[model samples]
Target: MRLSAEQISHIRAVIHECDPEARIYLFGSRVDDHKKGGDIDLLIFSKHLTERDKRRIRLRLYDRLGPQRIDIIIARDLSRPFVRLAYAEGVEL
Candidate 1:
């Protein structure tokens, strides 16, 4: 995975602080060590959050992770195709 153990812990802490019930997954290129130059792909499943809250969560992540590119997917529904795919292949940190 692209993220370090410390990074994952930091992310989990931030996520829980924002939404205590949230379930998080680290997916996409970051899941494969052999792959290179892929940004961090995250899928967060929580009760609906306002757009502003979503933005804040993302900004918080970026702030901690530095300038590195990362993508956050706020998922209110796990039945979505992409989320299901991520669940199948992604790791839960």
Candidate 2:
């Protein structure tokens, strides 16, 4: 994965602060070490997190990680095709 240990730690901390039971995954180009210059792709599974909570999480991440592209998918339905793909391909963090 492209993320540093500190980055991962910060991400986990921020997410857990909002939803302690949330599951986090890193997917897309960031998951491939050979890839370059891709945004951080996160697939988060949390039943309690709303759209506002998702926005707050993203903003907090930006505050700590700087102004960069971070694509986040707050997954509630595991049945969605995209969510299924993400979960299958993603690396759990």
Candidate 3:
């Protein structure tokens, strides 16, 4: 599905508020014009990933987006190697 500019902005806003130091990358079909059938894919990297933070993010996004399907992968800064590999392999938004 094509995401509206507003939706992207909302997502970015939530990410910024939830984890100011986090790096968020959009990927999968949500960012690919040639592909079909997929939800918004987000890879989030931060120095902190506490349970409370995760719950807050999920709750905030669920409130904004409703039941919309979203694939979110949260990782730590130490996982840069794997995240970089995924990016290099064509996971771009």
> Which candidate wins on TM-score?
2
The 10-residue segment of model 3 with minimum total lDDT is 84-93
Angstrom error of the Cα, residue 12, model 3: value is 1.2
RMSD in angstroms between candidate 1 and the native structure over all alpha carbons: 1.4
lDDT of each: 0.84, 0.94, 0.70
Q: In model 1, what are the clashing residue pairs, if there are any? A: none
**lDDT tens digits, residues 19-79, model 3?**
7777777766776677876777777777776667766776777788777677677777544
For candidate 2, what is the TM-score? 0.97
Q: How should the candidates be ordered by lDDT, best one leading? A: 2, 1, 3
Alpha-carbon TM-score of each model against the true structure: 0.88, 0.97, 0.72
lDDT of 2 by residue, 1-93 (tens): 999999999999999999999999999999999989999999999999989998999999999999889889998878899999999999999
Reference-based lDDT, residue 39, model 1: 83
Better of 1 and 3 by TM-score: 1
* lDDT, candidate 3, at 66: 75
